[model samples]
Each structure stands twice: as C-alpha cells, then as structure tokens.
Target: MPSQIHTTEAGFELTEDQNCMSELVKLCTDRPELVLFSRPRDYYWEDVSAGEFLAEVYALAKGLVANGVEPGDRVALLSNTRYEWQLVDFAIWAAGAVTVPIYPSSSPHQIEWILEDSGATFAFVEDAHNFADLRAFLLREDGTPPLSGSASRLRRVAVFNEGGIDEVTREGEGVEQSLIDARVAAITHADIASIVYTSGTTGRPKGVALSHGNWMYQTRALVTNPIGAVARPGKRVVTFLPLAHVLQRAVAVALTIHGATQAHWADTSTIALELQRAKPHVVLGVPRVFEKVRNAAYNKAADGSGVGKRVFLEAERAAIAYSKALDKEEGPSFALRMAHRVYDRLVYRKLRDAVGGVAQYGITGGSAMSPELSHFFRGLGLPVYEGYGLTETAAAACVNHKGGQRIGTVGRPVNSYEVRTNDNGEIEFRGPGVFGFYWNNPEATAEAKHDGWFNTGDLGEVDSDGYVRITGRKKDLIVTAGGKNVSPGPLEEIIRQDPLISNALVVGDGKPFVGLLVTLDADELSRWKEARGIPASTSLEELAHNADLRAEVQDTVNLANATVSHAEAIKKFRILNRDLSEQDDEMTPTLKVKRNVVFRRFADDIEALYSR
Candidate 1:
C-alpha cells in the first residue's frame, strides 16, 4: 500500500536458486582455489570452491530426495560455523526442502524440542562435537536403540569435517561421487527456504518461517545499497560472529552473491592475526570486538612508570580535544592541528595496526553500538559504520550507504522497505526483506502480521532527515511504579562504553529505582590492574568487589546517568563475574543478552535494591 514500491514488481522473474545464487556460482567456479573461506580444515583450502562446495551438497541433496525427502520436508543442520554448514543449508533448499539451522552449543533438551517441533526428516551434523550431543539425546532421553528397518521419517545424519570430503553415506541410498558433483538446480521463490527459530528468552522457541522470496529480497537489498558499494571483491575479511545468527549468514551469503571472495578465521581469538596476515579490505565486527581493539590501543600507548604515562595521556587528551572542537563546526586551531598530526603518527597509527593496518571500513550490527566507539575508531582513521536488521527480515532491512552515513544511528532503511510507526509506538515494516509467519504457530503468526505490517517489536523515532534512532525494544522498556518509563538499550549502550565492561543489562520494573547487572571486559581489567599498581586477583568476581574497580564502574554509571532523564537514571548496580553464556541460557547464539533469564535469575537481587 506504500507509494514507494511498485506492487506489480513485488517478486522478481528469475527462479529462486538461479536468480539468488547465480553470482555465487560464477565466483567460485571461476576461481577454484581462491581461499573463499578459512575454518577448522586449514588443509582443505586447496579445494574450497563454490563449485566444489555446492556439488557435494547437491549430491547429498539428491541422495536425500532419493531416500524419501519430499518437497517442503524440514531438515535440520546442526554445527558450528564452517563452509559445510552453509553447504547443507543451500542443499536443503536445492532439494526443495526447508532448513532448520540448530546452534552448535544446543543442549540435549533444546535440540530435542527443535527436532520434534520441526518434524525434521534428516539431519546434517558436524563431526564428533555434534555427534556426541546427538548421540546423548538418543540414548539417555529415549533409552531406545536405532529403529532398524523401521519406516521412520527421521532417517539419518551425514557428517562433514572442517572442509574435507563433503560426502554422504546412507543405509537405503548409498551416496556416490559423480551423483553428488552434479549441480542442484530446482527451487521456486514461493518455496520455503528456512525456519530460523527465535531465542526462547521470553518463552519457548518460536520458529519464524521464511520463503525463498523473503531471503532473496534481503540478499538483493543489502547486496546493492550499502555492502556492495562499500566492500570491493578479492579483498580479505575476518568473520568472528557465529554463523548461526542470521546477520552473519545473510552477510556472508551476500558476499558470496556479490563476488567478494573472503578468508574466515577459526575463532575470535585468532581473528586479529588473521586480519593482519590477510590485510582485509573490509572488517566485519560487532561492538564487543571494536571495544577490545580500542582498549588495547589505549593500553599500548600507555607508558609504564610515572612521567612517561602522564605525557602519553596528555597527548591523547590534546588529540581528542582537537577532534571535539572540529566536530562542533569550529576549525581546529593551527597549534591543535599540529598536536593531532604528531599524535596521529606516534600513537593512533600504531593502534590502527592492531586491527589490520589498512581496513577501509568496518561493518557492525547485532547490538546497539556506542557512539564513543564509533568516534574513537574514526579518530584512529577507520570509519566504522553501523547497520540494523533482524532474523525475520532475512537479516538486513537498513544499512549506511558507503560515503553516506551519520556516525551514531544505524543508517536509513536499506533494500527499499516501507516503514511507518503505528499508534502503539511499534515500528512495523513491509518489504521483500520481511519474512513470512512463524512456522506452524498460527497464533504467533497472526499476532506478528497485521495486514502486511510485520511488527519489529522495537521502538524508534525518525529524525528530520528520516534517519532512525532505535530507542529500545517495546518489551524491554522498564516503567517504574511512579509511571516514569525508561528504555534500557540506549542506557545500556552508554554503560558498555567502559573499556572494562563487556555487557550490562538494566533492570527496574514495577520497582522504585533502576540498576544494572554487568559483565566485565576481563582482559582489559587485568591489564588495568598491572598498569595502575593494583594487584591482580584469581577471579573476575574478586576484581568486581575491589574498591578501585567499584569506583570506576560507579563513575561510568554516573556519566551514563547524566545523559538520561532523572526518572531513567541508574541509581545502583552490581558487577557480574562471568560473561553470559549458553550454559546459563543468558545469551542467544548471537550473544545477545536473554533479558528474561537474567531478570528471573536475579529477581531477589533486583528487588532488594528498591528497599534501600
């Protein structure tokens, strides 16, 4: 109904797989040994081509179809990030099946619920790590043997190593080489491609159904507007975010579609060196990674003993002060510019090397980013921009166009979306990027879509220029007993500005005051101790209660409080020792804080603050 789009062109004319993935096939087939990806199988780089990857997966798909996989059958792929994980996903769609991507760290219970709910006919799992867990689920939970010779729809699971021999061995249908190497070429836009489950932070996991048309819209939007314009091909990249999250999946898939051959690292720890070695033209990172780089730069520039550290700190002060003056439309004084030039060569340039020397731009998403982090990086000579999207939007609906961005907010809506705010203060979107209903949950599906409007569940207000400032999630707002409402996201972003704090969740609903539960940036805190003459402790918990550390957090809280209204100010907080992990279900696979779990676990602690 929006005038911005021509409804007659609602869908593209090309067939699903062809239009969506033809470019990817071209790149990989053209260069078979281009090191398209790096993972646990370092030795397999010799054969890491899109042609090689897809052929084996297509062969497996054909085998599955022969072994009784019908159209619309939902299949699950359980694994950590690897080229094969993506292969299985594409193969499922190529076979006219829907994919259900399960996280690598899923416990037996979560996996069981997904398996039963999705009615998965087959599964593709990573080697031993995936097998041990699945094996455990079958044995202890069911306490039954494999139903030999049974006509069960849940047939078998194929395993692929880090990158070698993407093959299949089946009971009824033995998979062969040539059959697996043929191109898998049948799919329709209307066909369901995948059902990515929502994090069960509020309730049980709800599978959001997405069609090929939905992902295609997503792929086309992000690929053309911002990412395509920004990252040139043959440039190296470092991917640290979990591929289980749709953001990484969509971005990586977009790269493949756009002819950007990339190099991936095994894990986050190895990412820095990989970037340095690869000299990546574009760096895709989350706020946490950027925060780490900033802190490390700050530490590196610090001189050990008394006078040296003071002089270095003075230079940083002068550099930042000069930058701030320029930000206000005032030309930098000649003396200040000279000071910045000196500091740039001596201090900031060394910091840039810490994050791969020549990174043209860094792309960020998944969580709200600190404006401070953005400014710090730009000051250090890397222009890191932000993006906004969700799993239901096939990942990206908006992004900052190259050479077209304002530092703070996630750039305007990308991929040609129709956006309007409903009276309920919720942002409802309608576009090709928007997905279908939640799989099989009609109640949820109906609730999420009103006419064609997909409720984003986030709150935002538009700027004069149409830029959107995301305040917070509708459900994440905390309204005090006095009727004063506060959005935790902006405040949380401010608190996370601290170099030694990784994440913070602000809580205060139906209570007199607001407080925070924080996860510290451990490595930074340890370094801070050594540099400041403070003693080191065994656990972060001990450090959290340290007088100096407590005061530092209090100062950060105080600074953050000044930015919000009196009603929204955080009066108190407690520092948490461990980062929220899968074991606690305190975070989603994408590492987003599961608010419901945190609130429930510390209900007593949250309530006690109000008594004071």
Candidate 2:
C-alpha cells in the first residue's frame, strides 16, 4: 500500500509535505516566464518562466483535453534533450495523464513496443529523427509489419519542437489536434506522472510507472540531502546528461524548485567551453569525462617526448605537497611552501585550466566510477564526490555530503533515505523518494520490493562510517564451478581506471576463472598518439592488435589484478575496438554498459580466452 504523503518546508520555501505536487505547479503559476529553461546558444532561448510556462502548458493541456486526452491516458515522449520535452511531460502531467519517455535515438521497434505496452494515447516526437523512425515503424504501406502489434491504441501524435493544428491521418482514420488538446487539464497528486521503461538488458523492458507523488516523493531525498546543497539557491550548474534519465532531470527541474541559476544548456561538443563560461558551482559527469580529462593531462605531460611528462609529474607531486600544506591548519615550513609554490604555479594550475576552472566540487554518476579517478581528482584539489542511485529513487539516495566526502564510496544515504544491505549484500532502500511500482507490471514490481524496502539490484556493502561501496550486481555475480564467487563490477571498475580503457565487462559465470573483453577509448588514444608517433588515421581495431599497445594494457590489467585474490584476477583479456553504442543495444540511455549485451557479443572472445 502507498504510504501517507508528507512534505517538509524546512530548508526550502516550497512545501511542508513530500507529496506537494500542487506546490510545484504553484511555482509555475507564480513565475510564468522567469527563464525556466533555455537551449544551448546553439539552440534558441525559449526564455520561459514558471508562470508563463505553466499558463501555456495548461492551455496545451486544455487543448489535449478537448482532443479527448482523458485522465490516466499514457502519453509517450520520444524526443531529444530539450526544454520542449520537459514541457510535453509537464503538459502530460498537467492534463492528468501518465508520461512515457523514450530515448531520442530509440529504434523503431522500441518506439512501437513502448507505445503499445503503455497504451499511450498520445506521443510527442522531437524532430525528424524520431518522427521518421516512428513513421517507418507504424506505417509501412508496402506490406511491411508494424513494429509492436500495430500499436492500435495510439490515438494522437504531437511534435515537441513545432506547433500544428492539423491532425495526422492514415487510411481515413484520423487523429486530430483538436481531439488531443481537449483531454489535457490541470493535474493533481492522484494523477499518474510517467511510465518510464527500463532498458531491460536482462530481459524485456519493464515500464516503471511513476506518479506525481512518486516524482514529488523521490525529490525529497534529493532536495533535502546534504550533497543536494552543492548548488544552493544562487549556485549555477551546467547539465549535459540526457534529461530522459531521471538523474539529470532531477538536477535540472527538481533543483530549479530549490532555486538554482541556469546559465546555458551545453552542446554535446562544447562541454569544456560551457564549464568555462558557466563556472558552474555544480556539475554532473560520467566516468568518460574524468577519463578524458585525466588522459589530456597525461598526454600534455607526455607530449614533450617523455622528459616533459616526467617534469609534469614532478610538478604535480610538488603541487600536492603545497596544497596539503596550505590546507593544514598549521603553516607549512618555508622550504616546503617554496617548493609547493613553484609546483602550483606550474603543473596544477595548468591542469585546472584544461577542464575550466572547475576548482569546486562536481558529481560523477550514471555508471560505476573508478576509485582511482576519485582519488586522482582529489589529488588535483578538485573534489569529484561519487554518488549512487537509480531513476526509481529519483537520482540520489546516497551522496557524499559536500563537507564530508569519502574518496571511493558513493557516500551515505541522504537525510530522507534509509539504506541497508540484504543478506546477499544487495543494497535495499526505504525512503520517501522511492517510486511506487513498474507500470502495470505487478510481477516486476513485486520483485523490486520487499515489504516497504526497494530492491536496488546492486550488491554493495557499507563501511563502518556508512559510505556505500558497490561491488557488483546480484545478477552479474559469477560463481565458479569450484563455487568461488566473484563480483565483477569492482574488477571492472579498476580496469576502467586505465585511461585507454573506456569499458570492461568481466565474464566467468559457471566457468573456471575470469576473462575480460575491453573497449579502447579512441579519444584518449588519440591524445596518446604523439608519444609513440602513432598516426591520426590509426583505427581502434588496428590499435587493439598493436603489441606495444597490448603490453601497455596488460600492465594496467596486471596492476588492477593485484588488488584482488588470484582466483578473481582476469585470466585473459581481449581488446575490442568496436565501440558499444546506445544505438546498438550496448548501453543504457544514460550510457551505462549493458553487461548482458557485452557478454553475448563477446561469447566468442570469452571462449577464445579459455581455449588455452
């Protein structure tokens, strides 16, 4: 049963109850056009505030309502990251309907599957990209089959980036704009919010039904957490992670309710420039970002043909010593301070300059981050506090409180959440923020909950101080024929610390020992080119077979292997140059590697690894 709702207005001026969806709407009512969101300079500024935004959205909701968009209707949003996508979602909620968000790059089959599964009465497409895909899937006049059982339930279609009064028709069956516009109206807590489908690497995608109360409830853990204060009312942040993911959405809109300054929405390319321009007090990043930054620093040092790299390392050592001395309550000795000053002026300053003066703390999430990356950032005097959570929990259940961050763990549960480890070490959560259930999938929902506790699906343990250390997924656990249990996520994380390695999936389940199949991050390798005089045209596949490169990777793998017992060490590894892309079913929309996909694709490689 759903718990009674409560809200708190302690630190925020918003609401006292966690389920105050109306208060969130009231923010829109009060400031209709206070610059709620803007696209990157690459895109145009809608310059909408809460009030005007809500007014227009409510008008659109009314439009949908008039078009027969009845309450509880599921509306699908298959669009790219943009303000309009949020608007459509907001409109869906405003109209007292459920929203189903699809990745902008979702294949035609997925589009139809979600539409059919959620019984979406309406859908908003971003542009020609998804619009074309949906068209191809739904209407193949040349005797081709529809992607998902004809999606007979779909009654209306809307474009997020454009406005039109005309309805679309096929075979004389028409869906009119007027019909969609009629069903939308003001939404309330009793209204369903969204039906978000999981990527479902293990099986079929399950629609995770989130309610207005669910979004509102999960937000408490984030808006009330210690780390949630990273960007206070006045702080600025830049977001690049896809808004389709709840993590990024919470940081953008949910945090807005907390009063944050939005500078710009960055293009996928100019994130570096965006950071420099925004000087964001808070940032969200994936492991790839950190790896790129680390590689750039190393390459710059290595660019002088080895001697320069050594000098850079020496300078870094000096800088760390200096930073430590400065942070010490007691002043450093004159001699040490003098050495530190020299290093600070030379190495550390340049490194900081590279990624923009992101001297303050930022966040790293989406997938597992290497502990070395965490320690490396700390060494540079930039705090990259790790956080762990899922969309179901609304972005953050545990985050390293800004004032007290652990180097490796994903910090403690936020003020609003309680985290405990089950007997199998899987993290279980009970919080105001936990989502209710998967949309219409009682079996999946049952599996995800135990009493009131939400199953995190991740196997982890808490340190004595309570920081969460994720080891692996319960599903990813490998029990050798000899009954030696191995959690691959830890080893995989350690392997990914190597700048050249973007992703590593360990396979050994039902086998004797572990083997690794890896992906080379081409960008980092391009940076490493100068040291070995490698040409720009060198392909990742070619690089994979390069003996010299293989030796370098082996050395990295060996170092990672040393941290664990011999039985758990990766017995063999093969470099895979083929990038695992979201389009190819290799990654979640948030860019987390799909472990099942990796294993299946590399079955031949795994067999080869064990052949000897």
**Top-scoring candidate (lDDT):** 1
Model 1 over residues 1-612: C-alpha lDDT tens digits?
322221212334444555354455565677655555544443544325556665555566776776567778988888777666666676666566788888886767777778767877778787877866555334223534353432224555666654322335242145443443332344556667788877645778888788877777777776665667533456556665777778887777777656565665546767777677767767777777787776666665553456545655666576556645656676678887887788788777776687778778788888877876776666656767787777777886666656557667777677557666677766667876688788778898898888888888888755555566677899888998888898998888888877778788898888788888887887777777887777775577677677888899999899889999888899888877577776677877666788988878877767666767
- Separate clash counts for every candidate: 2, 38
Summarize candidate 2's per-residue lDDT along 484-566 as a digit string, tens digits.
88888888777887767777888888888888888877767777675578998888777777898889889988987998899
lDDT of 2: 0.68
lDDT of each: 0.70, 0.68
Which ranges of candidate 1 are over 4 A from the true structure?
1-18, 26-35, 38-47, 136-153, 162-185, 230-232, 303-339, 531-535, 538-546
As a whole number from 0 to 100, the lDDT of residue 333 in candidate 1 is 86
Q: With candidate 1 superimposed using the best TM-score fit, by how many Å does residue 510's alpha carbon deviate from the native?
A: 1.3
